[model samples]
Target chain A: MADAKVIPFDDDRSRGGGAQRPVRRRPASGGRRKADAAAVRDAALSPLPGPQTGEAGPGPDAGPAAPAEPVRGARSAASGASGDAGGAGDAQQDGAPVTAAGETPVTADGGWDRRIAGGLAFLRRRITGDYEVDEFGYDAELTDHVLMSMLRPMYQKYFRVEVKGIENIPSEGGALVVANHSGTVPLDGLMLQVAVHDNHPADRHLRLLAADLVFMLPVVNELARKAGHTLACAEDAERLLQRGEVVGVMPEGFKGIGKPFSERYKLQRFGRGGFVSTALRAGVPIVPCSIVGAEEIYPMIGNAKTLARLLGFPYFPVTPTFPWLGPLGAVPLPTKWTIQFGEPIPTDGYPPEAAEDPMLMFNLTDQVREQIQHTLYKLLVQRRSVFF
Target chain B: MGKVVLVTGVARQLGGRLVRRIQRDPEVDRVIGVDAEGPGHHLGGAEFVRADIRRPAIARVLAEHAVDTVVHLDVTGTPLGAGGRTAVKETNVIGTMQLLGACQKSPTVKRLVIKSSTSVYGSAPRDPAVFTETTPPKSLPSGGFAKDAVEVEGYVRGFARRRPDVAVCVLRFANILGPCADSPLADFFSLPVMPTVFGYDPRLQFVHEDDVIDVLRIALHEPRRGTLNSGTFNIAGDGVLTLSQCSRRLGRPTLPLLLPAVTWVGSALRTVGFTDFSPEQIRLLTHGRVVSTVQMRETLGFRPKYTTAETFADFARSRGPGLLPPETLAEAVDRVAAALSIGVLDGAPVEDGGPAVTQTTHSSGQPG
Candidate 1:
């Protein structure tokens, strides 16, 4: 058995300093390295496996020349050999024959792992910075408080936010905040997060499910992460909910955020019950929140999909003057925001396999959407201002 | 150049005349008449739509007519102590709710003229001062006490808050009268006997029906976007006239009576069908009240075309041979006096300077 190659995980030497020692990479035969690379490709392409610890390896100071036990559970290496052998042998049951160069066969099929690694690298680049409390501070705790404090004046002076049924939000565990999305910029979600943390009894931090474009921006990606927003993916949603955190999602999605000003407060197309399925899988209650006043903030005049694609953004919103004037017009008018939380839709009664039932998921999603929509209309009528 | 206007409750006297006046207005495009009882035979030229507003479905019917402005004049509740006045709650409160709901759905409805009442202010103190838009009504235990005051205001306010783009104007009226007036004044004059003061003086305000129509027209043409107190004037013909003076002006003779005894006897007579005055009416009569209309005059540019004296004169002239003779007026007065002696009306304790009592003029009515 040959030792697997070791790669240094953290290479930002400035942060690690002099205390960090160099990691040793074991030199395998050409056939073996090729085999190991092929195995890594196979594992990367496979569906996410169940929780398993990585095989124990040699100490950090171990020499590259040292012979060690083959890394158990490195299924990728065996899968690669099986591929090279045209599926002749059971890669898991018996070690595949090594090539003449004494190294594992190297295949160019490790594209998915490289892409995922690249994404992770990109995330790291976006996050590493001296994010001070000046010019949009990035401290998660402080940012949460500041976002709320910034909204307090408008919430109090203009709109009387009557938050009902906040007890629906789970205290310790992950919960999905499935709220009606209004307004052009999804400011309702931002205000909702603030409302939950500032006004809810437990003051739980809400992890928002933002769009992919949000995480693709330079400064915005980092800020979103600090604010606890990840890509609005079911995987991330399930992960957060399973961890007992409050995950806020605007099921109305891009349609709700990009609705024309004429249909400003109306609920748009909900994305095929994805949020409901996610909640069902996680077995979390869906808190329905209806937000009034956010619709009037930017007032989406139209959308430019061509420009959005050209700029690598989702639905380029043409507010009063948003994209034309850039950041100047992008500033949302300080509208009085009233967010009311309706009774939670309990998914605890439904089994996790219920997510597989499309019809059931659709009906449940529609029910939630309708409740939020009706509540929004009622609240809008009750609200007294466009801008506080 | 008449602008098209739709007036609901057009079959009612005040609403009927309003439809006619709006139809005659050169600025009005046309008058669209809507009523539950259908258009009065005299309401010619104007297109009429028959719909009972108590039902929610009427909202959709009204929305289809493409009415540019709506003057809602239907009253659901009868006057205090009138049989089935409580039933009026459904029509006045729920009807208005339905009407406003319809207005929200209609894109053509740019202006809403709500015909509210000074009753929303409830009974006021004896200040001879005018009640303005800013005066908040006092809270009362009775359902009607707050129903007219709060529910109506809530509906209108809610509409304005939800739909700022729509221009909504509320006209809080005083007692309206004219040739077709069927108020207590007509009943009092027609009575052979009239009841007089027991211990306190009572002052009543009335706006001529013609003047009410005039104000509605002003609202239609001007379309002010806030609440306005309109058509509230002393019905005494000159200034604040005493209850006895009002009876005398109507050619009725009044007999002074004991307050408690009058109330008790009035109640007894009311049960016997000899009189309409309840013990409550007796109590209210003994307590003088007034509401200001200075804001209506200043903001809406309203000047009453007909004074109270002229209003009564016009009514008397219209009755012609059917008018109540002086001798008949005396007999009616006697019957009213006897009715007062019996307790028919039950009066609530009057507060002198409460929020409901204080009346505001034009200056106080201005929005901040």
Candidate 2:
């Protein structure tokens, strides 16, 4: 019950505002994976002074009471996975009273002033070209302050994404998160990134592997690169994993996202498991994830094959309201969404040669595929309706 | 017992500077500067020999000097004083061939240093994030300096095989940027209003012109205890900058055009004799190139003083002021910050005040 109060709509933004505060510091504690769930619960319940209490009220209760229950579960599960981040909760608790006691004088005015100063500093830095991008062209500062904030509203209010079993992801180290792709467009990927970021105790970023088409397009190419998405190739994937990043790959590619409305939940055949070999070579774990509710967002009833070929697209989706409604039909429907991260399959136990072994790669790929398919079926069965 | 060095392309700015620096080295007894034309400027104390490397006559000069160390600084991206694309190709490709042939026959030539450009790694959508020395280019250059560099490298490789005894070192330098840089990229950045590809902002890397001379100097000399030896290495500074970032730092406004329009503008500028806006250069501006400098550090045993950003900054200082002054931009930023904070404090949140207060307390007490 105490944990339910922590589900604020803009916690991520609040964290951004307090960029100068010591609250952003990672705790110096040792491994405490067992305390993850408790830490998350305690962090949620920690008291905050002033305006935050007013803002937190409408976030979770925006939907029905039934949906609010799972959101609490989602937060707990997310926190549980990042055991080392137990220190984050304790640190916040220690800082809470200091802010609360000084609520009137220091907290209210100082917070807004600091936020405005930070905004100005950010603008100045961007204009003066004072920023660092990694070799893969990932701009972490821009993604955090600008891009993530832009997407948080949609992830929080529109689909109301609930995450489950987040504890399955390792708090640190390289990980390959394999998820079934859907939603006519790949909005699910963005939502999945948001779910992992907001729920996890450590708030680790997910570096997504995108297709070549993403890089070929004009505006999308620059945005995608800035948002830390690299080409979905073995070299890039291996390079990212070797650097200890959490990489998200959708092996199904266009096939899963462009499937017809008749086969919404039926999992498509994942392409030759290149992701598995990449993980094996890097000696990291692979976490299988299943996303529900993205399929119903657009509800593709038919594929316009002729138009697709003409436009040089994989498929031109003819959704229920699309084409007839023109630009207005582009908006996705409001559907209740749930994303579940399953247990990570460790590939470190295998020999270095295992990456080259076709049999082992194929078997591991099938095992991961089956686990995601099974979870999808279960989540579908538990659902009361498409739109809650 | 002292070394006799032959430095080609002394007529150009960089070559003249390099020849002057090499002449000062105490270990070298003599330095011979060779080119098609005599040096217009000073070359310190180095002997100037007016001879074309593209002809067989270069062999007589190489043998007469008994040049043991040969530094090829002639491979250029654009025509320097008075030459076109064809002239550039002849000097780069044919010149290198004739010089290598002379080196093969002249037994005194034991050390060779060739300056190659990173444009050989043609930019494309499918390229790796960072290119190492061994990474084959994803796409071969269609035409221009890039293709010429690729061919020149190929000939160098063949020459290396023939003379395995020769300590041949090939240095592939990234876009050279510095106070005295006369590179195509430098000229492009110096334009009053730079034209950019509409949707793409490419990540570019640069090495200081001083660093190139330093690396070449090390490569030309014989291997001592802990210095460069014979091998192919990528030379670049420590960091990368986006094309947009470069424009902003230079305080210049960009004219974003569609890809086709950009191509049209490139040729238009070329015809007007503004700069050599070749197709390869356009491809570079579209999908920028970056190379790994690990070998340059560990294997070659050299560390560049200026980073990519610092090199660009040095280059930017030489070019005069832009339309938008730095002080005006700074003042605007400060004013906006103050106004925004004050506005938020006085208004907005209070307008929805009553409803927000009740909603906050209601939600907080509901759990209890």
Candidate 3:
């Protein structure tokens, strides 16, 4: 038999000097044969295997010699549903379609597909960048990003974080940011970081000294890293402060965050003046900050220590609707967070060896405590809402 | 006609004496004695009511008695044993709370007299300016830190604020000493072998039991309303003496064994349950503490009947020879050296001649 010549799909010469070739036709069997021929013809006319690779492939363990007919049929069905063939015909008459996948032919500004693409790209970068927490100990991860995103709208709209006396935060030196912890979950610390970053003239990152339990969670562990939190160790605080970094600490810590709702604003304890000792040792200024609105967010009505121990948490907080509301109650009330930074108490005058003097440490601690208490009363009067 | 007064812990040394003193006052119509262990063996005159002040129900009992004045003297536990600090706080703090609550409900009650210790002052710079009622107490590191001092004050302050008609007086007392004084001072003096002193020149102060009773009597009758320094005075017989002088006065030989700084030893001793005095006590002892009684005398219009010397003599007479006689100066030094050789007082600093002794004959006894 004479060899039939192969013709390229887009070869100009094969199309007989610029004349277009006829579309491939199928034989009519006038019955099931005709249906089968129609199916084959439809499969051949569909777009090639690309983009949706997994769906086009044959079932695993299937013989490699399996006919390409079934795969082609699946591709044809997908292309038809998407109207790709119709678009292809238009492109054949003109040039290739000047549009992206799933995009409208017109370059409309409000196209959903374009917006989705841009959003996906942003999400990709957010998931991969330095802000992305991944490692076991430290990394930016999804929950942190989600939380930040969830809080961004509210932070920008109703919550106006104004950092007063920011110059009190050493620009190049380590500083101990002794803030009052209020809310059951300590969202105040989070807002503190945001406030420092957004409102500080230097846009400095405030490394928070968190409790032991915060880093103990699987998911929250990574999130904490991205948020730049470390264990609330005197050594860690001293190191960071000595390095000239701004360090945030809650002297009240677990006691403050877990205090009974009746004692909401009353600071429980300052923990034996460790913070003061750290500040004195590092010779850094202690910036006293008071956060209002957090106490109202998740008022710690009670605590279940047994359950907390079982769950490896410090104290299982029982707010009004928490645990009863389950996951929903975990969502903090969108309280209008107002963090006010008081003037920094200069440790410059304090002798570096003052850390050894328990009396001196106590005096300094009392001063810081008095400042926070005084500011809290003022901020409480100034706050407008329990939740926005 | 006289006013009725209720006193708790009336069986204890200070409490028993206070009850006796209150009974002798012609102005006291009837004295009510309350204690957890029934009436104390020696308590007399006052009606006995057995009740635990820690229980809230006692407050009701107090109200039922139609008590007009309350002299709170019961503390949960003394600072002498395991959980002593906690026990003391519970009794002193929580018990005070219940008592104050009772006073609040009783319409007949006109005054509350609280016996607070100068321990709240901790170790402040000894400026020779005696600690006055106006001076804020220095915060302490121990569990007692301002717990009793501040909370009792708060309760009384709050009570007065709520009912301006009632008068609340807090008496900040210095170390109380005398015959049968069951305080840590008595215990320290009775030790088989005295603990090594950090230095040789620490000053000591003591107030006679008679003076304490007199102050209590005055507080009950005096129309004063605010906080006051009651019995604390520089009761060192008008002069400060070195440790050697104190040992000599007690007929004990001076033993000079160097121990680590008082702060370190005091802290270690407190942790190991060896001493009742807190780290603050060591600081106070090594540094010396003296509060003037000018206001206590002028405001209360009372004078101390016994001098520091007379008080010490009475204490010695009461104990007789059963109280360990002071070791001979050379013998005391040898005993300390032996104890140090066995590492019993490890990390103790070396001393020159002997432990610092005060001229006051109370002796360096461990406090109960």
Candidate 4:
């Protein structure tokens, strides 16, 4: 229950990089303070470092507390602190032999050593194909270690996303997260993914239902699949829910993301309420999520239809900086984001035949749409400024 | 009387393997292997008949043998022997039509087993993550082996409808991989350096060749079990491996080219007698295909022992070493892992020297 130490991104990296240096004064003197911090932080976060965390707590003060102990203890603790338990567990198993040999007196060198070992092990697994991908081509390991890390900086330091009502999502079983999609490039969907992953207590992954266009592109298609984004079809949605996965769907589609900035927070038509029917058929609850501030990131002032046609894009945005500024214009504004998950509407109460009832689908879609729209307005009023 | 079974495409490795396997089954009285030419490999005790399924002569052979069950394995995705694409199409489509036509007239033939490919559900951007047997393909195959499969399945359906008494079983298999796999995918992996589409890393699924033979053998005797009540089922290994993962596992370096360039390279490789990387294969590589085998397990009551990764691993072992040996790669990985654990100390520069010595010793211990 201890709060995670929120270190400034730059400070965290600088200290981490310094640990890889060959020369140091004395192991205990140089490493004591940071090692103590890591031990305390990780002990509470992960279970793999339990023994090591206990051992490491007193080592820094004792100075000569088992020369072989500190390095293994710190290494496991440091990696374990990264929120990747699998990698941390592997590091613990690997470091076991080194500790037994009592060969090295490497102190807080834990930070970089753990990273390098975890990275090398990851590379080995990838080359040897010693990994599992779900039937949806979702690589959980890659998403957890690589993709999440890559997106974390932007989600944390840049957007500073504040998630509210995350408990509305069930800790286990299938749930449909219907969020209003915005941001010209659809970066909201990714940030939303990160928000759900990092903030949720149970750490559930959101299997996003992406439009067909995402799969039509080359590199995008590959990354999309690895990141667990399947085609936004009823079959895929129903299947994911059936398998007890949290499926994320943006009913607004391109209309919400591609519309001019003037129409920012207005919810678009919820695509024939197909998602509602899918949820009903799967007998899961629908969690309506409203995201504010993503619309301000690109701020599309105009649309170049001809250029969009030429490039085969849905709409080419002539943002304040884009087209004229070229590649540099693509950089999004650092807007503060607030994503709130509303109370889940249970569809399990409906009869199985309710999925076929178009009238019910319409009413449910409208209810979800209105809840999201109301929350958006409420969030916008609460905010002092767009970028704050 | 024991069942009389006629197996087509026996000249191919899979066909020959299936024929021999069925011949050993006690329920089958006689197994007759039919093809345009005699099988180069042994077919155990099964009788060999040199009759192309594309011709009406197949009907005469079926009548003379009083064949009650026909196992069609002639649906080929690649050209065989001296035949070209046209020949493959003829063998797969026209051949299936003639065979089914003959079976329709033969009242004695009450059971038919068709070996189909999951490619019938063509890979496309809009495709569902996993395909069930009844899922309609998002995009029908435009041409080549996939189209031939579609046509063949169509003909089989018509034949089944015309003869309700006939129990037809269609086993749609994923790509097959094994030690003795002669599949196009096997050839693709055997290349010293595999060429892949630049930006696409498709998730590939494979069924072990042994699993395929086992399923076929079961399908051959399925009517007696009564579980094979003329149903179509998907047969694939449990897991999936991305194309990139497969190449890495094989220790084969990849040459990632543009989509158009991959097609050009494929044809060039075909012309050079290296491998037939067909258009259908190119699309598969672009948008990988995966089919659910739940029905194969629950309905057909079969489970593949080897997963997709395991099947590919078995095939990679048979291929020997590629540009980089897997053992050396594994050793390097271990060395790096050990060094990472031990190397990050105040004595870092000196620690670097230790791995250099250990690497040399590791390499010396390994054979070329």
Query: lDDT values of the candidates?
Result: 0.55, 0.76, 0.56, 0.77
lDDT of 2 by residue, B1-368 (tens): 88999999998888988988888888898999999988888999889999999999999999998989999989998786777889999999999999999999999999999999899999998887788888888899999999999999999999999999999999999999888788889899988888989878788999998888888888888666776578999999998888877887887778888999999999999998889999999999988888888888888888998999999888888887676544466567777766764432221111111222223422221111
Candidate topping TM-score = 4
Per residue, candidate 2 scores C-alpha lDDT tens digits across A221-271 of 887887888889887889889989999999999999999989998888888
Candidates 3 and 4 compared: the better one by TM-score is: 4
Model 3 deviation from native, Cα RMSD in Å: 29.9
Error of 3 at B164 (Å): 2.4
Which portions of model 2 miss their true places by more than 4 Å? A1-110, B224-228, B335-368
TM-score winner between 2 and 3, please give it: 2
Q: How far is candidate 4 from the true structure (C-alpha RMSD, Å)?
A: 9.6
Evaluated on chain A only, model 3 obtains a TM-score of: 0.63
Reference-based TM-score of each model: 0.39, 0.83, 0.40, 0.84
lDDT of 3 by residue, A1-388 (tens): 0000101122111222222222111111224433433443334322222212433222221222112211222222222322543333333322311222122234233222322332233332221121222111222222222334344334433343333455567667878899888778877888787666544545466888887666444335334644667667665566567667799999887888887778877876898889988888888889998877678778778899899999877789998889889999887775555566788998878776878999888888999999999987876665434542
TM-score of chain B of 4: 0.90
Cα deviation of A152, candidate 3, in Å: 77
DockQ of each: 0.00, 0.21, 0.01, 0.24
Model 3 agreement with the true structure over B1-368: per-residue lDDT tens digits? 68889998886878877887778778888888887675435666678888878787777776787888888876422542335577777777788888887778878888777777655555433222134555554444354534566666677677778877776667766666677787765655554444544332344456677787877776777555554433332222222322333343454333333435445655665676655655555454443444555566666655677654455556656655433243333344445445544222222211111011110111232110
